[model samples]
Target: MAVPPALETPESDGDATSGGPEDLQRQSWTRRTFGAVIENPHFRNLFIGNIFQFGSMQMQLVVRSWLVFHITGSFAALGTVALANAIPGLLLSPVGGLIADRAPKKTIIQSAQIYNMANAAVLAALAAGWLGVELAFWHLFLSSFLQGGVNSIMMPSRQSMISDLVPRDRLMNVIGINSSGQTFMQLVGPGIAGFLIAALSPAAVFGVMAALYFFAVTFTMRLPTKPLYAFAQSDAGRAAKQARSGGRRSNGFKDLKDGMRYVATDPTIRMLIMVNFLIVVVAMPYTMLLAGFVKDILHKGAFEQGILQSVQGLGAVGGSIFIASSASKGRGKMMIGWGALLGVGIVAFSISTSFWITLPIMIFIGAAQAGRMAIGQVLVQSYSEEEYRGRVQSVWFMQFSLVQFGTFLVSILAEFAGPQVAIGGLAALLVLAMGLIALFVPAMRRLD
Candidate 1:
């Protein structure tokens, strides 16, 4: 019920009354752009660490999807790998959120990175034939499954830690900057991974990915072990300490139930979750099916797919920065507009047969996605109470699992009706869905 320590100091106005035009402009620009990184040492570390974290993830996405498609030559198998990754997140992410609320976030983050590094190392060994085993499809699937579980457990802490590190007024700015950092990695990591896969081997790409994860771990190690608000005179703080003292089992389920009830009762959180979930399930499946689509429809190979992803990242970087610099008003409308644009871009992409044409469309899709994510996340973090933030993010993250399930269904459709038809139809559906939501959800449109 009390104000958080992080929110105690409001964002600086930076001499709006006396400063000259250039001074005011510079102050406004810095506040919107890099204020979080410049002001908070912890957040700066997290920002740099995320560069490595996202690099490994972006590369893994390209490599793993390509590996499955390359080995099995089946759209169904690609969807299966996605599904394998989604299942653990769906089942356990709430528990992960609970752990995040109670545990030392730095420890949780470091442990997860170590696990990911090990997973990548094993995959690299198998791919290189150094493990005396051929890299089988099951091995990839198993690694995906395990990694998904770890991510579900780790992501809540990582996301909620942002609020711990900065003031409430700067939440949107920092979140956008974070998105841009990840997008920047996307811009280069995939292309590099693709080139490595082409020049050397998949094993070498995996090896590079493992090293990136290690760097991420080292950076995360510099964050404070305890949260900024850990000693605040609040029930959540006490609960955190008690939970850490090995009392979690007795009240874990109760905490989970309480978190769910909190989300269920809050209309803004509920609407945001619904809209995000719909977009993920209806509009995002194209990504899972992208490799097969490129191969079958665009007549491209792994390098081409990676290039497309990199191009998308370029769009994402521009989009995230734009949102970060924009006024934090009408964010709900911004989210809706971006979501609709994403559908429109996907439709364009699905209809295009030429790789060159799809290149520009991928950029459009990437920007739309970045906008949708940044705005939607800002709204969620802004509206949720500090104590319930981690649990809220965990529930929000369930969309990942649902999107994978959507990918599986879309993959089956692609197998039967061809990638073009399946993808195009889904894009049309997303457009229609967003339009209806905009028409009916007036309250959501009014949210800032």
Candidate 2:
């Protein structure tokens, strides 16, 4: 497939009419306030795909958390399951990124979805008693590992593909819409999953997830076959030449190294990655502890856990809408700064014994989390060069995966310190880290 012409790169002059800082600021305001992604066909398809993908993924997450707790009745198993997912991404992300660069991104993403479908199917079959056997903990671990590997590949391609689908001016808006989709899935998917699990079996939830993947595959197939960026085409050419010459085997590690070098040298990109790392490491683990919060801490049940998760998703949806409609160019940095205040919200969640109070806190946490994530994605996508997009995206995936590792660490800490204390401590640490980040990372501090 032919590659699309690269969109004109955004100039750093900071003018609105002249492609300067002022211009970018004005454009940013428009992007944040409106649903800009609807204007692009490719992005529209991607957005639809994301809705299905995130809905399915989040549903699985909720179900898995419920399942592990139901079986083991321990918080550590949550950490273990999280670890199983993270380890593979950390190990394989570089390769996934490299493959995305050298091969057809659409193809890689499609294949990953297929792999995920297969995993989901296996889990469902096992659950449905069609493949009856002693399903050990190792089964969950293996499935998580494969899913993580697929995510490492899928994320970079998906992130890099956004710029291809829209003009540079619209990247933030597109990202906002993307965030909204994820948040929406979070809101609806988990609630549905919870209801289904309550009404039926864990296997039924897996079957629904498998069906969602089929929808994802169908949506992805509807996307344009062409490579989203010029650099991807160039990378493809280089890979072909290398393959013909037998110079080096084109694999993920080589691609990962190249991506790391790019990020290492670029201060803006480095800052973005670090900000993501800090947030995920410090604040992301709260989701893993939800079951504990509901069951043990709050003295509630599985149904309440699902409600809490849904409330968080509601917050994300609201934040995504606000960011999507707001018109501010350099506001991404501001969003990061302000969004970090979510740590305070999480802290409140930890301490609040009242369900009413905890519900609002979870909502704020979700909103702030969505805002931070949307802004962070826009910053990363805007700063990366088109040719190295896959590698860059892979690095993004690695950061998220590694953050999950950090979350796992937090889970381990919870095992010792207890869930409430661990969650509250992490939230405080995140607030402090955000302050330090704002002070140190100029890109994260300045608003255009």
TM-score of 1: 0.86
lDDT string for model 2 (273-372, tens) is: 7778777778877876676778787888866776787788889898887766655466645656655678888889889888877888888888888888
Query: What overall lDDT goes with each candidate model?
Result: 0.83, 0.73
RMSD of 1: 4.6
TM-score of each: 0.86, 0.83
| Candidate 2 runs further than 4 Å off | 1-37, 66-78, 132-136, 228-253, 295-297, 412-421
* lDDT agreement of model 2 with the native: 0.73
Best by TM-score: 1
Model 1 misplaced stretches (Cα beyond 4 Å): 1-31, 66-76, 129-134, 229-250, 299-303, 414-421
lDDT string, candidate 1, 20-53, tens digits: 2244245667665776677667888898988998
Error of 1 at 204 (Å): 2.7
